[model samples]
Target: MRVAFNVIDETIWFIDRPHEPWTVQAEARAAGRLDDERLRLAVRSALARHPMARARQAPWRFWQPGFAWEIMEEPQVDALSIVDCPDDAALARIRSDLYGHPVPLATSPPLRVRLAHHAAGDVVLLGVNHAASDGLGTLRLLASIVRGYAGAPDPVPDVDPLAVRDLRTPLALDGLPGRIRHAAALVTELRRPKARIAPERAGDGPGYGFHLVRLDAGDTPALGSRRPPGATVNDVLLAALHLAIAEWNAEHGAPCERIGVMMPVNLRPPERRNEVVGNFSSFVTVATDPEDRGRPETTVAAVTAQSRRVKAGGPPGALVDVLATPLPRPLLLKEVTWGLLPFVLERGLDTAVLSNLGRLGEPLSFGADAGDVAEVWFSPPARMPVGLALGAVTIGRWLHLSFRYRHPLFDPGAAARFATRYVGALDRLAA
Candidate 1:
């Protein structure tokens, strides 16, 4: 049986940014098979293997099986041309475009794939509507496509999106008021003054250069040296970001005690393994104060502890409950007023976001005899107010970092500098 899930307030925020397109491009050596028949067969097999591609959603459902594919075969359709712009600019354009083209709930598809084929090979651009599928979902679809091409029995049967239980049930946290105050105090004490970096303007050109930096597995040991007990690479990355913001603030002469980092929490559990679909995420802010004179390890430990407390206290679930309630117009307005609590809590917070997807395990290899999968990375949406986004994923032993920023808010030089500083901070912690 299917049930229509009411769109939450967070989903409304997603709807407002219509131009923030979530796209992924996979470029590989074509091996001479770029015919229409092959493409159709590939897509048909992909659809069959990735059942989520064909699932449809009503007002209450969270996803629809809509997908589109286009094959471009012109000399101008170079692989470089397909992904020329820096991911951040591409992301910015999507968000800007989204603001203008607010996609209504009814017309948007759950997925889209555009293929640009050249004499060299092929580049597959997979775009998913953010309201439905996320990075994990995209990877799942791609894996299924690869497997289907190889004639593997479907990896796993598709679970109806509606059938997944919402673990975000409201919980009673009677003493939560004090804990919330303590969390706020921790943020305040750790708050750092940060200046917003201005991004470069989009040039007359159609695309920009894209580059990547992968930290080696050997480097992990060095970095782990300084990590306090219970601190993972994620904690180290968060610390680096905190330091970067502090330095940026120092360089720009901005207040150093007001910056905040938005951290997304994945709410999925082990039992719901196959229910890997849609935006199953919520967030908490880690406030930093550069003026605080604690060692980097201590700062991270404090932040981690606060995060643990918040997670244990279950405020995220409470938020889900509050937002999910079906209220009348007056009550909805009241809820909106109350929802401002996040903004209030985050006032003077730096508009940066950090997300870590950890490792992706083995590359999804179709029965292809060639090209081993090397690395994978994803850049989540970085809309305005939140002008910078940092995403990391470890494919095998290589840690891939994708830093996305609004073009108008950061120049390539600044971005490069920021990346270098972040790496340096990580190295410092490792040492």
Candidate 2:
């Protein structure tokens, strides 16, 4: 599928500050050793393994040729003051600076890396350009880099990054008008007016904090049995989230009758799975109103069914495919404009988003001595206007979830409370 508007531009940005550059050092402690030569070799190996890293084309254009690297042995004294500052604050500063930053048209700066060395040792700050990669892609790059360090032969076959000859082909939209009407009917049945659930208790607190919690693999079964035929961890997780939000609303005396979750669906077919690249995905919102929650078992069942239906029915990108074949540039632009302008003007139409990327492959290791990746967490952007985004992924057998919220709408404590309550809901459901 063609890239989305947000994906076309560089949606992700990172800043490399020296003092905290070694954050990966702590991560290394969990995964393996952090040897300098091995790290460099690992990066080279990743470049070789993923063709996108070396690709030079439009749409599928992956990495920029060169990276911005700076060696700061002793940064200015002013830098020391912000050394201990949190990542969010640093990112906010970078966002402000972005307005004046010169982003080259033809040759944008490649992904930036910062090398900081002091008496303590060396720390590398790798800043990825978001449009070119997702969290999974970044993890793969790191894993490949580590494997190269250990001289391990590539685990997967190297596929040509641009080999998808008909990647732009959209799914058949025959009877689309009828499908839209049917979907509208389902939505109308599931719809509930938005309720202003009370903000998290720590709504006016300081910037947010990220905490990692590990649930035992053995106990995973206790969380909940798979729904009859089979239900994914995402389905279970969604059910639990729905329950938690329901409970939270009840506690605040502003019980929300329904809640919606915007779910992202990756459009890449099974054959093109190895093509590591940008956001080749679209989404449909799975909404669960109060009626669905009345019968808990039915609630989960309906959610599972609705999620499957949404996945089966293609979204706007599917329409883009049919138009791309015959429409001229001007007409195509106009068509795209007509399609997306309303959503842009209305902000996002969904209330909250829950993106589950399922299980990532084998544990990613950087060096020969690298250990399997225990868990992976991705925090999607909580763009302005849209307040909340939840993401979860399985690395090995562990499930990691993150809740991202806009500062104006939520505080760290509130997020923590929500997490606590959500986990509690899951535990209760498992019981």
Candidate 3:
């Protein structure tokens, strides 16, 4: 059994190579001792339900009629691994695998799991191929694995636009007026200036590192409340990022123009927010204003205004969808060009991205054997050119702030300093 993937899937399949596989890294702690047997069984059951998990991609060639995933009866690659090491070492190992250990994309399941056993407890790390699923989709997959392991009911199948097109309602109007409006929005976004984050010529080389900081629950919500009325946590965070960039510029002495930020907006339908997996996200671009960001308050206000437009389905988000529309595109050449830039630029020297998973849809847990989820964090993939990315996750009261980056542009020392500045930016709100 096989099916053709959409263009977005095609793009990910190409961008992701063995050494630089586009994968999402996630960690969750179990409640008690986790049963390896149950975990293994759960994987098998979950794979049985989702054909994509046990599928293989056909080789890519210019002449290939079309790209497709051939479904298989059983998994073609290892699904899980168990390691004995300290918690810190395990986290390091997981971080390394994003660019070090390549996922067998052609034959293996699009995801892999590892359990690191330390004196304190186990940290469950999941590595999911971006071509197969995004971060939230992996969470859903993880939930299924846990439920299956704990002798609970299987996860409900996600909605498939292809499978139920006729029965399902259309997402938006495709009339001439609507199309014209979408096109206009795309043009406006294209005209918006982007930021130039200049690092020393030598600082933009290869190699990568991950740095993390935690904010207690009390302060996490404060990040949003302190912003102007109606501003969300996301708005405050973006404002904080702008301030961090300013500090970085001051520290580096690299005077540059605008610094554009591209955020991946969750586009999954409300019904599928929790259950559906796969790539249901689009990009929205917003640049920081020095005039407004001059002060922390003005910065938050400026960001809030721009972001509100985006949340209301403005140009930035519409731009991604216009280009990401599946093949047989209206304007093949144009869409294949500008429409594909976001995917390329995010990993290039154009803009930095911040993806906040907000909060886990359901409590992270298994049964009595494995404890409830104590903490959960994910790192957005960072590759060369575009050397830095910040991913955030909030569990109960604690907010986990992660800075994932590629080397030269930012060494461990640089990321550490940026982390300090990031937290400091948030602190400015209190002052």
TM-score, predicted candidate 1 vs. hidden true structure: 0.71
lDDT of 3 at 360: 67
Model 2, position 84, has a per-residue lDDT of: 20
Ranked by lDDT, top first: 3, 1, 2
List TM-score per model, in order.
0.71, 0.67, 0.85
Q: Per-residue lDDT for 208-303 in model 2, tens only?
A: 234334565446653435233445567767777777778877887765755766665666667645345444554455667788887556567767
Q: Could you tell me how far off, in angstroms, the CA of residue 375 lies in candidate 3 after the best superposition?
A: 1.2
Cα displacement (angstroms), candidate 3, residue 215, comes to: 1.9
Assess each prediction's global lDDT (C-alpha) against the native: 0.50, 0.47, 0.65
What value of lDDT does candidate 2 attain over all alpha carbons?
0.47
Candidate 2 lands at a TM-score of: 0.67
Per-residue lDDT for 37-67 in model 1, tens only?
4444555565544434444343422233222
lDDT of 3 by residue, 282-355 (tens): 56666665687778788777777888776665344354345444345333443355457665444323357788
Q: How close is candidate 3 to the true structure, as a TM-score?
A: 0.85
